[model samples]
Target: MADGEPPKPPPRLEESVKQSQLSPQILYSDVVKAHSQPYSQQPFELNTIFDAESSALKEISTYQGKPSVVFPFSDKQVLVEKLKYVLVGKFSHGRPPMDTIKKFFVSLKLKGDCNSTIFDKKHIFIECVCKEDYYHIWLKLKWFIDGYAMRVFKWSPDFSPMKESSIAPVWIRVECLPLYLFDEMSLLSISNSIGRPISVDPRNINRTMLHSSRICVELDVDKPLLDAILISFKDEVSKNILEKFWVKVFYDEVPLFCSFCCHIGHGTGTCKRRLEDIRSGQGKAEILSADKVFDNMPQAENSTNSTKFVAGNCGSKMGKQIRPSMEWQPIGKHVPNARSDLDNKVAPE
Candidate 1:
């Protein structure tokens, strides 16, 4: 293709997407192989350097004529005494507390959630701004707000199974939209991803004009991973709107490895429970079987636990099956066994 020319369909758009050339794709092995520095047993020059660096940071952040440090000393408030002089002393020595700096952040309502007493003491408000990086900053800021809400506003924790609590969003996008854009199949997958609070709104359009159709996701999770996942998901959604429209997702931070181990990561086979299916002589490993009954089971909804055995409804369906035994005895039908009639072993001895 000439300069300014977009490349033609390379026969397999899905494969092309899997090989996206843009960002660094650090694999699990890569992270595991990185070198880590050992902790020192004794105080070294590095401690001095860190102290000096902290001092410099405080120097740049001074707030008032009193030489109030931008960063407070490790401790600013006292267990029992007027603390202003101690803070002043630390600021004089350029050793404002890192803990106090965090307090300052909360006071400014810069952290997640908004109702913490510190925020009350500091006072702040929430606002939305549209800009180049609005989406990214918005996700981060939401988490901070949500955190504040939980701690100070008395909102429930994000992951806890509680109503009235604030929550992180779960970002979801299927890259195979070109193949199954608005089908029930993809919608169910999206629902599985939204987790507890958020809901899914599917795209309604016929196949002929699906290219012009668009899919929108509103979730409560973190941003960066959501954005990264969306990039990969572009290959999944086959809508025409995606041809020129940039795909984006932003939600709260969800740990990639933990989610992966919980069977929320890529491809179903690597899931531990999925592996158990193979060990138990279930059907072979499958990506999308025509009759993936387990996948369709209502019990499978939004479950992070994959270790549980998937016991199917054998012939009698859900009711318990009675085991046949030659020694079977109906309730109060038979006399006690000879062993029960006999005295204890010590009594016999």
Candidate 2:
């Protein structure tokens, strides 16, 4: 062909096929052998085999399959508007009443405007105008429900089940754990009493750190449970006699792990739970037992056979360290920075 003239259209399909008939073909067995090595033992760089552009395009196309539609908004509207989440599980046999679900979410008065519709027998589509509202509901509902065996998931147009990993246990340093809680089982019992999944960290198992008043604990419980435990301990150490047995509970303000999923480099706000909430809702959370610390108490190894008591006058102010009435406030509100010296306090008869 002349330089100025465009080459004629490629030969007909039949001619091209005939000309390339002798080309060698890669056998399926050869392809299989090429990739037979374990992924870890593979010699080639893993990234080399991955086609980034093609893979990205494939994902984009998959997402585009059932793209979300944005409804037209009024000109006066100033907000970005609402998004929906799909809650799924083996639900009741028929469609759940929409009014009841809507009323339930609204009663919570979560951060957003909430609405619900029966997506199907097994799925409920919940919509919240505010992202915060959408999240709060997911976190609270993921763990337990009154009587329903169901899970909360993000509403996906493609209707695929959301895939999410469970939140992992977080390691937290607990300060002023009572010195009396010496054994692992005792500590575990007390830890479990807070109505959450917790354990004495294995690192503290063999090490003799109970000599110090602080220890590390790993928790898989929800945030509310942790707060409740803190509040409970606060109440315990307020009274004079009870205070002698309990220590002020203090949690590490700066944690190495994510407060949400208990992973590093993140906080509860940016946790995997939220990520899962925005994608597919997480799986069923493990339910914690209602047992409290004192309920299933670990027996003391050594016991005193006999006890001697020194009686004191009921109205005697002889050995009391009288503090100002203002200092007698609730433990939850006012806590001393240092442990109080209860040795000087008057002993009850």
Candidate 3:
């Protein structure tokens, strides 16, 4: 009690508590390390190509691993240029007079430069820069070529794709048509068998051409589908009927694309499959048969005018024609003909 000494300072509570609680602990996990080699020098490849051909077993194996698909929109713009268009018929004995061909293409504005046209021995190939230009050249040269007929086919790796004779409705001349077949009902049935009947010559029901056996029918069908139907019809008739009524598919000098393949720049005559058939003696020798062209029409939306027209409700005016009765008539019976003198502003004497 009598000792002189300095008093000791009290211990800090926070430091003492922290020191007591502190302890070393270990954590464990699988770690992935970067490879020693650079990415370009890596030994492994991401994609693998299998040599095995497709079969039921192969399909079953890959079924679970299939990637999610994105369906293309129907109206999606085709990114690739439709560069090729074909010119059929003999342009010249040798290399087609390139000068004349170039002038023709330049005149049509299809090809601005001489380099765009490539001449083959049997056909001339014109390179169109865009789809629109390709289509324009196709339509322009289809029917009215003076010396050489033009046929535009779809581009394909192995062969030309099947297409219509023309974008417009095809006209088929039915020769040796019996008097009985000239009736509206019969004609309509025939047209329906082929495609949507656009019109029969002398569309007026009263003024139907009874005297002439030949009937010219305009069908709202691409040439290929119509040709297939015609061939089938002709074959069926050939077996039963004695009178060989020739059904002339009027391509009118325009060449047709091969029905076997859906290409635009070549005809069935030049098709590899067709040539092979020819070599094997399986090719058709008769000129009466139309070259089978269409396997199927392009899938179209209801938005197009052609489809709307085929649906028979093209315009707002057709609404009035819808009657409560079963019968349907597009043209009125009592309407005066615009071509007649009575309706003309200046009556012809």
Instruction: Write model 1 residue lDDT over 292-335, tens digit each, in one string.
Output: 53333221123233221111121232212222221211111121
Report the alpha-carbon TM-score of model 1 versus the true structure. 0.19
Higher-lDDT candidate of 1 and 2 = 2
Once superposed on the true structure, which residue ranges of model 3 sit more than 4 Å away at CA? Answer: 1-79, 82-95, 109-115, 130-132, 143-349
For residues 159-270, what per-residue lDDT tens digits would candidate 2 score against the true structure? 4433221222333443344434455775555444332334465545665564322333333222322221221122555653432222223343322234344333354445
Candidate 1 vs 3: which has more lDDT: 3
Q: TM-score for model 2?
A: 0.25
Residues 126-233 of candidate 3: C-alpha lDDT, one tens digit per residue: 555554555455444343244655544333223322233323333444432444456666665555544445456663235355433222332222242222112112
Stretches of candidate 1 off by over 4 Å are 1-119, 129-136, 141-165, 173-349
Worst 10 contiguous positions by lDDT, candidate 1: 83-92
Arrange candidates by lDDT, descending: 2, 3, 1
Window of ten residues with lowest summed lDDT in model 3: 303-312
Give Cα-based local distance difference scores for all models.
Answer: 0.30, 0.41, 0.38
Q: Which model scores highest in TM-score?
A: 3
